[model samples]
Each structure stands twice: as C-alpha cells, then as structure tokens.
Target: MAVAAAFTLPLVVPARAAAPAQAAEVAAKPGSPSPAFKTVGLRTQLNWMQAMPDTMPLAQMSIPGTHETMAFYGTAFAEAQEFKESPQKSLTMQLDAGIRALDIRVHPQGGVDGDRLHIWHGAADQKAELGSGVLGPLRDWLGKHPSETVLMNLSVEGTVDPSYCPGQDTASCMSGYFKEYVGPGKQYASLFWAPSVQGSSRAETPTLDKARGKVVLNVYRNSAGNPYSGWGLNYGTDAGYKAQVQDEYKVGTPSAITTKWNQVQAFLATTRTKRAGNLPYYNFLSGTGIPFLTPSDVAGGGSTGSGDPTDPPTYFTGVNERALGFLRTDSGERTGVMMMDYPGYGLIDEIIRHNPTSRAGTAVEQNGQLNAFVRASDGNLVRSYLPYDAQGTQGPWVQETVGATLKAPKMAGNPVATVRNDKTVDVFYRSDEGHLIEAWRPPGGTWQYADFSTSGYAPATIAGDPAVVNHNGVIRVFSRNPANNHLMESVLPTQGSTAGRWEKWDHADVTGAPQIFSSATAVVRQDKTVDVIYRTADNRVNHSYLAPGSSWKQELIPTEPPKGEGKLGEVAGDLSVVAQGSTISVFSRDAATNHLTESLLTGGVWVHTDVTAETNAPELSGSPVAALRSDNTLDVYYRSKDGHLIEAWLNSGSGTWQQFDFSNPVYHYAPPQIAGDPAIAIRPGKVSVFTQSGTGSHLTESWLTTSTWTNWDMTADNRAPVLG
Candidate 1:
C-alpha cells in the first residue's frame, strides 16, 4: 500500500459566480444571496475511519451524517433528503461515501405487540418500514466495512406506541422488542455498544477501538414520556456523556442560511480550541421553518426537493455548499458529529477530511477490466463489466444504476465513453436541460456523477454533443456554446484541488464568437497537441489545433478534395475522429450526397476518400462511428437507408476498402433490427458493435472474431443488480 501524505486544499476555492448586488438593496436586504450553484456529486470517503487510530475517541473526531435520513418521501416541506430513490439505496450511497451518523425516527405499527416500525416525517408517511429499510442496511454496511462504527439517534416518530404503554412499564414493554430482535443470545445484541442493562452508565462514549463493527445507540426520548436513561446514551441533559448541542433548525427563512452558518462556525471554533472532557458536540446543520425555505432549500439550495435544474435555484446559497467552502479551509478540527440534510455537492467528503487520522480524498478507485453502460428509460445509468483475464459478452449487464443527476433534468443523446491510462472509465453527454453530465467509474467501483454546466463551470450555455479528449491523465471536455455557436472547454481539476469539479478557462475557446460551427470532434496526438475538427455552418470542414503551451492554430480542409474531385464533399451529420500513431481518420456524411466520406490527417497534409462511392456502399441514414484495431486497421459502421447496419473497413497497408452487411442472410446469424446509429468497441482478437432494438427498445450487440464474424449479446432486461 502507498503511504498518502495529508492533502492540502487549493488556496483559491471554486464557487458559483456571485451576482453583483444592487447598491440600493444592500441596506434594505438582510443580505444579498450568495452566487447560486447546482449540486454536483463527488467521490465519498469510503474508509477514512480505517485510517484513524482505534484509540481515538469517536466523540473527539468529526463525523459526517444526515438528519431525518429516510424522510425523502413526503410533502416538499417534510422531505429532508434530495437523493430521491428507495431508502436502502439512498442510505447506502451516503454510507459508502463517508457518512457515519444516522438520524432515524420510526413509529411502532400495530400498537405495542408488533415489531413493525413505520418511518414518518411529522404528518407524512415516508414509505419505509424500519427493520428492512434502516436496520438491515446499516448492519450489512458495518459487516462489510468492519473498521467503522455508527452512531444512530433512533426515536419514536409518533404518539401511538408510547401512549399504548398505559403510562407504566413503558421501559419494560420496549425491552421486549429488543429481546426479540436484538437481545440475549442474539448475535446482534453483542454488537450494540450499549450497556447490558442501562443504569448509571447511560452516558458512556466509546473509543473507536472499543466500538468498531458496532452500533453506538443514542436514544432521543422514551416511550413513557420520561428521560431515556435506561436505553442508551442520553442526548438530552443530565448525563455523564451528555451532548453539547447546537441545533438551530428553525432559521425562519431561506435567506437566513448565513445567520445559521455563523452560529455553526462559531461553535466549531470552540470545539477545536477548548477542552470539555470527552463530551461530544452534536452540531446539527439541518434547518427549516418556512415553506419557501424548507429543508431542501437550506440544504443544497434547490427548490421542491428535486436536484434537477428545471427547478429554480433558491437565490440564497445552501448550507451544504457554504459548509463545503468553510470545511476545506479547516484542518485537523474536531467537528464532533456534524449532522446535515441533502448530503451532496461535496458535503460529506469535506466533513470527513477534518478528522485528524484520515486520508480523505474526492475520488474512489477500483481495479476491473471491461465495462459497459447505458441510459435507462427512467433516466438512470446502468453498468456491467468483465474481470481481467476473463471471458464476457458485450452487455446491458446493468451492474449499477446511476440515477438522474442533481443538475440534469433529462438525459439526451448517446453516451460517449473513454478510458484513461490509469484505467478510469468515463461517459460524457449533454442533458436536455442544457447541462453537461459526466458519469465516471473507478476501478472495481460503481458509477459516480458530476455536472459541469450547473456550477457555471462552462464559458457559455452548453447544448448539443459534448466531446472529450484525454491526454496522458488530464481530460478535456468540449461543448458548443449554443447561444453563440462557439466551441468551449472545461478542464478536469486533476491537480491543486480536491473539489473534483471541472474548471473552465477563457483561452480554451476554439472558433470564437460570430464564427459558427457544428458537430465538433477532438483527438490528441503522441506529442500532446490536440486537434479539433467541426463542420462550418456553410457546410465546409474546418480543422483547429492547440499544442501544449501554445496559441490556437486553424486550418480548413479543401471542399473539393482529390478523392471526390468531381463530387461535392460537404459534411452533413456527425464527425467521428480516431488517431492512430501519426495518422488521424475522420468519417462524415456528404451533405449534398448522403454518401460517407473519409478524411485522413497525416504529416500536416490532408487526404480524402469517398468510402461509399469506392465500395459501392448504400447511402447512410444515421451518423457513423469508427473504431481502430491494434494493427491500425479502421472500421466504420452506420445505419443504412433501408435500416440495416453497414460496416466499411480499410487496412492500413492496403489502400483498398471493403463493405460488410449484417442484414445479409448468407451469414446465417440473427441480428436484432437496429434503430438509430451504431457504436463499436475492439479488444485484441475481437471487434464489436452495439445498437438499440427498434421494436422493444432492448440494447442489441454484434461482434466479430479472428476467422469469421461472430457475436453474442445482452439487453437491459438481463443485467444483474450489483449496486444499490
């Protein structure tokens, strides 16, 4: 294992651009709202606890958590979380990414006789039963990540159960449920870091070493309407390990977030410098008092509890966003247990980074060989992969389902995929909401998401297809600023920042304003110079290049090239580019003639070929996708005029080009009726293509081997559920 040095955050913090406040309103308004930014998810601190010394007091460390964690299914005013999904799946995402505290409230159903516990948020039912939704997942997480411990504040959410106790023996009645599910001879009971029989030890706070793999219970109130002294750690008053609290949950309105933040910051300052024995500080950052400033608004600054961009921003910045800014500047501070709502936009990772013994970062990486991904009808992303040195089929194998991002209201276009030298796989696309979303997976891990457009990370409003080029480990994502039809770029923050957000620069503009272009494609050379080609609005092809540490250079391909000298060679649709060593290949459709044209870039010279005319290929109906083999042989596939998949191939050494039709019956293979365009992937001995089934919307796949073209495929229906 590599020893990681402590990470220092960048001096300049990235935030949404603040709108200039009107001079007249400065005195009248309580405060001008902070610049608004959308919620972009980052990698969680999965095992930071394992890096901490076991002897450290859990109370002396900073812990990130959610308040009313499962209260997401109710009226907008009652909902407390924005990661909308089933309780188990939502909770697990938080847990895997460094959340250690859970604030759960449950109402006992069927009176005092039944063990069924229903989750609620005041007047609304949250659609979850305790045993299955909350406890089961927690136990499972502790079992898998045994180096961690959980602090749960479980309280009765309703009045019916406690009222059923007849005002006497409420403690005795509650003891029965524990004995049934978590009592003597029950394996679970031993893992509960609670007194065997609560007495004078009601306020014991254990060290991480003593409570590893255990649930440290904290009871808010008792069934008998008395102090919860007999159950576990007393969070109220008058206990040896009593909690020092700062829960200003009723901040009046959304604009009062600054006031609430000042209070939280002042409290944390004291916890780090002062010594109050081993007493823990339970600083609750969750607040809501008005309908407009509900929990959703105060958390991530999104209105209506929806993370999508269609919902308007809450003028005032959210607590989660602000907290992230403050926490990044703090070092080795004991935040105690910092509870919040809508734990996103880098909120969880920022909180865990304050722990003294942590090696916290903003990314999660794993080791795996092959993977596939797609967008589901419900707007979720699914993944499937094969292990290294293993046999596997191209699939819609659906390992993990990444839900709609907080910034994207709707997913649009096909996902563009790439793998870096470090084996990090990423899928980029533009959302129908004019946002650019990146769905990336770490080695051996599931998909994680980030949206560049939401935080004003783009130079202009993003729309249309987005292009990505990876040079070494640095990735550059490009999108056209549809407002002015100018090409723009946002570079990944791979150094000097732990925020994991992409940053945009003014100098990256290719085809500046007033110079209109479409369907831009990018490719990187061995020398690290990037080349981008786009079709001019006038139907001519233009090429631009940018070398490292140099200014942008521009060129135009001759409209009447040598390959199709007597014919018009204007680009009509998509531009697909592939760079092999010293040569670059670009495929496009002729605007005047529906024929596919191949343009090659080599040694600063341009060579053109009309593949459709040369091979007698049928006219193309959809955009074409090109792939390169180890030997530098290239193959391009597109949907034909008659709806069949047509492939055009050419060998590097030979100038000859050939055509293959998957729809031909002579090969005797069953190929699904493919709709739209086709995608290609190649390994050492095999090459494959995937499409969407025109009839039932299933994902269709076809491939070829050494001696003959052979294929096996899977659709979205057959993917195994491997993620929450």
Candidate 2:
C-alpha cells in the first residue's frame, strides 16, 4: 500500500513526512549513543547488503535509518541522532550497525562549493558541513566496502542562501548543487545509480545490483505534482515508486506518547501486509511537540505521575521503547525501513533482524537450456537445442536438429524463435508466396508445422520476418503485411475451439496503428501491456501499446509533443524490441549513418541513443540483434562493415559502452562466416546467436564460453539439411 495509497500531504518536512523535524525545535544537543549501540552488529551487519544479491532491492529489506542523521549537535528538542560532539563519527557507527538510510537535511549557504552548506535540525544548525562532514565519509566507507550501499534521504532543512532560494522548488536547487560533486572527474560522481535516476524513476524500483557501493536517494521534493525530473525515487504520490512514510512528530504532550507509538505500529502493520510490492517503505519513530514533549521525551520515555497533586499522572512509553517491545514480541516479517530518532536500546538490532539472511536466486533461467532455430537452403526449418549437449558432456554445447526430416515445413527468409509462456518452443517464418508457416514443438514432443495462411486460421500474408511473443499462453505473432506494409497479428489460443488454430488476425493494436515499413518488434511489459515498436513509412520510430480493457494507443517516439532534443533517428533496418524487467528497449539502425541505434522506453517515454555514436562502434551492416544477459548486461550484436560479427555491451560496472569483434582474429573465435543477420538465445552463462553460413548451406551457431567464442556448423555437425 506504499504508492497505492494517496500522497495526501506536502513533499517535504513541512508536511507529515518532514514536519517532525519542525516539531519541538528548542536547541540542545543530546548525549552520546545509548549503552545499547555497542551491543549491535559486533562482527556482522557492517556490510549486510553484501550478503544480498544485486537482484535484491532495498524496498524488500527492513533497514534502520536515522531521522535528521546529523541532528545530534542541536538541542534536545531538535536533535534526532545520538553521539553529540562528533555526530559524523556516529554516522560511521550507525553504518556499522546496519543503518542504510540517512535522513540528511542540509542548510544551503548558497555557494559554489559543498562545504559552504551546513547540516540542520529544523532552525537549529548542527554545525556540520555537507562535504567532508557528510558525503566524504560515505564515499570512503562505500569505497572500502563496495558491496554495501547507503541510502541518503537528502532534503533542505530550514532555509537556503538568500542568493538562491528555490522556495517550493528545492528539489531542483538541491540537485543543482549536487551536480558539482558528480559527473566526470568529481569525487562522488559514481556514487549514485545513474540509470535508475536518469529518466522518470517511476518506471521501476532500484535493485541492489544497481545500487551497491553507492548512495541511493530518497529525495524530499517539497513541490506540487510529481517530481519527475529530480533525484532519487519519488514518494509514489503520482507514480508507483512509493516510499510510504509515517513521521507524526507532534507528540502533543509526553502523555500522548502512545498515540505516536500507534502511528509507528500502524505503519509497520499496513506496509508489512502490503509488503509484496517492490517499493521502499519508511516508518519514522521520531517525534516531538514543542513545549510539552521534547526529542528525549519521545524516544527515551519522559517522567510520569506528577508529585504536585495538581495532575495525578501522565503515563506513556517512549516510541523507541514501544517499538522494541512490539517488534520483539511480534514475529511478523518485513518491518521495512525503521527511521528513528535514537536508534539504540536494541531497536536498530530488531529492525535489522527482519532482513532476509539469504535469498534464492531470481533470474529467469529457461530450464538451463538454450534453444534456437534457423532456415535451411532446402527451405526447411531446423531447430537446435542445447539440452546438456549432445552427449551431455562437460557443458560443451552440441546441436540437436529437428526439421523436414521430422515433417517441419519448408520456409523462405530467416526463421525467428519464441519461447512461449507454456515453456514450448515455436518458430515462425514466411512461405515463398508470403504464407504464414508456423512450426511448434512441445516439451519432449515431436516437431510440427501448420500453414496457417491457408488453414482458415489467418487470412493475411507476411512479407518479412515476424516478431513473436507469448503472454500468459496467448501467442501473438506480428509481421509486415505483404499488401500494404501494415503489421498484422496472428493469435494462437491455449484453450477453446481456437486452441490449435493460428487465428485472430485482426488485433486492435495493429489495426489502430499506422502502416509500418519494416517487421514490427513487440515486447510485453511487466504490466502485461504489449508494446509494439516499429518504423513508419516516413522513417520515424513509433510505438503502439495495447493495455488490457482499453483501446490501442499509438504515438511517436520520445513522446507525443516530444519534450527534449532527444529523438529516435530514422530507422532503416529491422527493429528488435526487448523487455528487461520493467524496461523496454528497441534496437534499430540509423538510416543515414547505418549506426546501431537504441530507443529506451521507461515511464511511458522514449530516449534515443546511437550505439555507434556512444561507443564509436564500427558502422553496422543490415539489421541488429539484441539480448539481455542473465547478469543484467545488455548486448547488441550486428554484422560489422569489415565482415566481422560485432558485439557492443553495457553493464553497470563499466558504466560505458564496450565492444568485442568475434572475427577480429585476435580473440581466435571464428565468426559464423559473415552471415546476413542473427538470432540470439541467452541462458545462464552463455549467449548464443544462430546465423546462416556464407559458404555452402550450413546453419551456424556462435556462442561465448569464458574467454573464447565458439562457432559451430550445425548443418555439418548434425548432418542436418542445408540452410538457405
């Protein structure tokens, strides 16, 4: 219920989330960390996220974060953290105790340098600089322990420099100042997840693999509407990146402590029941109400039962004490992020305990097997499977051919493969006369083919290769229409009378979309929306999404109005769209430059990039094939101008474009003999591309093994029919 609930408050501290900082601002620093601080994480928890896989997200874990982390220097009412005199050092101690998120409020002095800024607990200046006092130490800690990631909930405290008061637009001003320490050659340049925050972060949540060794952001944007272009994940106000927070700081009086504690308990209960989502949850246990309840009164319990007979008694338990008791007594899972004032007295320990010690691997490994298909010179469809290899020897892959010899139909042009949701492998291609020829093989079943174009299933004909996707056992194949160049859809149902037929030719998505000049590329989004990307006759890239229970919506790339200078180049070759988690990427070739191009879709918007321009990759020939590795690496493979198969890859480690030319002669990996285009199938540790051999009628497969690329001729090795 994080983002699902309404964002009914302000964006910053003045609202419910940050208003607690404004409560009881009487200046007075607190004592050192509680006696319980030294008892937590004696040898463990220092690098807790280290044990978690990169695939795991902080949203899924229960983290302990400090509210007004550097607030220990201010007065008792203003302070949020413990260990005065050197609160920055206390930060290191908290990090050691499994505290991952920091609610850091900075008082911007409005200068070019970060040191001019100071940490503030409301109006009280904590006397801490933003640079060496805050980020500098965090950078050093992450550098030493690259596996551990820190989440900084950055915000503006009381006021900013008179020279640059952003007023309600503090998000922009804060991000602008942060730019000085990031980007090329800066100290904390690579300290944050660049890609996650690049576009509208609402598209998805940040996974640990993308956040480790850096400071993840929970930016407090005090503005109207969604803070789409700012830093960190939004509070799920208008989007789904929910950071549900409960910071009810106004504990009216010390006697009202139970009320404050109830908010903490309620937030935990609500978020835990709804914890199935992939959004970070915040539960603030720090609060103070000016004249009645101070910071100390709210966290460590205030005195009760008046000796002066005027009032008989005022009974309440400190929020932290209540939290420890409730969390210790209850065995509920997922406490989310426990943002606290004084996170000691075994409170931090209890919160950290909710995190999973070990999680099962979550990659979508397809039965640990690779499957591919190719067209033979005899026009027969040949399917290959790497099921523990031919002799099941040492993972060294071998081919198993199934085709015409087994009643598979003859086809024209290249054959494309699809792994349906039912785990069945199906390949489709066009007949010489543009008929729909489909071949399907069930798990451990014999190969089969049906000419749907003439079987009363589909009446339309395909002019080129097809893009196939199976959503929930419903197969949809989109191909260019031979007559008018419009992409046509042929559906195969898993049930009812249409189960065996490739029927349903007129899909609302295709019919509503404009005519396309090339084969359509389609991918199903995480939300089950089928997004088909194609190039119009005018050469501009376009997208059409089919959301359930709604009409098909089509628009040009970037957006309808096209906000920025960003635009997808004129596509000249076949487009390939791939869906990685919540991200959809369409790969194409720039018409004028023939450079491998990519248009990434996130937050319902597109951002274009020329791979050749970004990486200086050699100009590509024909079309490009793209596949995302099991390790989150995106690879774009294409035929280079020099007749070598080129691979351009992008991963977080390098954070840049890198390449490999298989036929460079230096790697000693022979190419597939300079083929037209390729089909890629990726499993756990390897990426395999099926291509047509230039010599003879061989269907060759090229794959990588550790440091070497291996190219094999399936036609010759398995005595299979020749490829066209």
How does each model score on lDDT? 0.60, 0.61
In model 2, what is the error at residue 226, expressed in angstroms? 76
Model 2, span 122-147: residue lDDT tens = 77877677777788888877887776
How far residue 693's Cα lies from its native spot in candidate 1, in Å, is 1.9
lDDT (Cα, tens digit) per residue for candidate 1, span 612-659? 877899877566777665445677887675556788887445557789
User: Per-prediction count of colliding residue pairs?
Assistant: 5, 13
lDDT of 1 at 406: 33
Please list all clashing residue pairs in model 1, or write none if there are none: 366-443, 366-444, 367-443, 367-444, 383-399
